[model samples]
Target: MAALGQHAVSKVKNAESQLVQEWIAALEASGGTRNVKGDELKADTREFLQLITSSLENGAGTAIGAAQWEDTRQFLERLSRNRAQMGQDSSQTANFIFALKGPFFALLQKEFASEPQLLAEQLLQASELFDALGLHTIRTYQASREAVIRRQQEELLELSTPVVKLWDGVLALPMIGTLDSQRTQVVMESLLQRIVDTGSEIAIIDITGVPTVDTLVAQHLLKTVTAIRLMGADCIISGVRPQIAQTIVHLGLDLQGVVTKANLADALALAMRRLGVTFTKAQ
Candidate 1:
């Protein structure tokens, strides 16, 4: 594809301020300026426009993948990630680049008004260039958003599995929601680490908030119990409700060799008894 012409580049450079104003106005009118400060938006538009004009002058063709466009690519990557972090959608992020097309085409039209064919050629090149950049911004935005989501998920996992010291030599893990292999791994790691940290002799896995219990959940529970045992700590499975008990029986899942309780209170009592600790009610 043909590169942006020298005449077009000169016009864009000379009309940089005008182009930026028009571009920013267009973006603002289209509601693309949401969540962005005025000064910051202007600064970004100014910088991007400058980079584009300079890169074009230096022979950066419509092929944005060219080496000459490396700086521009980096700029867009940063822009995309920042926009994603700012809670902007992919279309809005990409529109930051696509929005410039109008101002650029207007400049080219004025620059090549006398030469219709040349105007068309330059317009096409500019469109192609901006489209490529916008697509790159979208792709980068998606990747950044995915990274943010994954981080949030990991944080949620850490939050959901909290190990509390109920008494001396006893740790309690209150679990909510479903139990999958991924969550089981996190649970085991957290419980085991707490056991090591406090040198606790017993750990209770409470599932009062768990909505349902299937064979998979039982298996996960067993796995966690086995891991805790391997860590030299006894594991007590608590919160075995009537429905869950029936499910376990219906599934014929064997929780053999694992102590279970109807509630956390009972489990704590059992743990305390096993530790040979006795507590009396205050009179």
Candidate 2:
């Protein structure tokens, strides 16, 4: 019985020796190898695994040293858990286990025999986590587009303004606050619709209460005028502030044919003259 046990141990150790040598050779062939320290660590890990396997085969009490074995076991458990938890934000990536290749394990043993695999696991997890984050971002952006469209619709609804028809053939829309392209479009549509409804050939766009103007507003103005002209109507933009005029000039905005007046009254008078309609003073 004793002889048989001794022979079994020798066979196992001899086979393990060749495996250890082959592993070292393969590790050397692969670049990114540690020099002398890595060799020493590999030797230690090989010895530890061999002892554990031999003990299992021999019915010995235990092959691994109490402290070292416990520590290594715990280290592997933590490494696996941490690697799986990488990209923890992704609901789909939970509870994943790393299917480490044999070469990968050998590399780990060589480089990280002394310490736990914390750094390696963390690095791996971080890579996956970024992927998970990218997926989440894509999903968020997809959802946000619909939200933005809905918000745009709500904004269009809120852009409803008050149009005051001051006369039979003249109408005034006092645009208060700022005007963006969308709001300007809404305003233009409302004015055009009202013009058609009331047969008002002259519309006064009073901008006295408008906070400021930019190129976008100027462009919207151009579009509004074009639409009104298409409808056989004319628009007189009134209350051009000095600053707004300067900005338009500086931006090289050409309002060559678009009529502009000094104030709302002037715009109304211009509108009435073009329409050949006059309001007489009571005698």
Best by TM-score: 1
Model 2, range 1-283, lDDT digits (tens) per residue? 1111343335445556655555555545543123235665375447544643454345442222344344434433342333233322222221111111243345434444566654355335323533433343334434444565688777755555667798887888888877777777778888988999999878888888777777777777788888889999878899998888788889998985888876888887777777788789999
Tens-place lDDT digits, model 1, residues 1-283: 6798887788788888999999999999889999999999999999998888889999888888899999999999999999999999998999898888887887788778899998888888888899999988998999999999999999999999999999989999999999999999999998898899999999999999899999888889998899888888899989999999998899999997899999999999999889998999999
Pairs with backbone N, CA or C atoms under 3 Å apart (clashes), candidate 2: none
Model 1's alpha-carbon lDDT is 0.91
Error of 2 at 223 (Å): 0.8
Q: Among these predicted structures, which one has the highest lDDT?
A: 1
Question: In model 2, which range of ten residues has the least summed lDDT?
Answer: 92-101
In model 2, state the lDDT of residue 190.
85
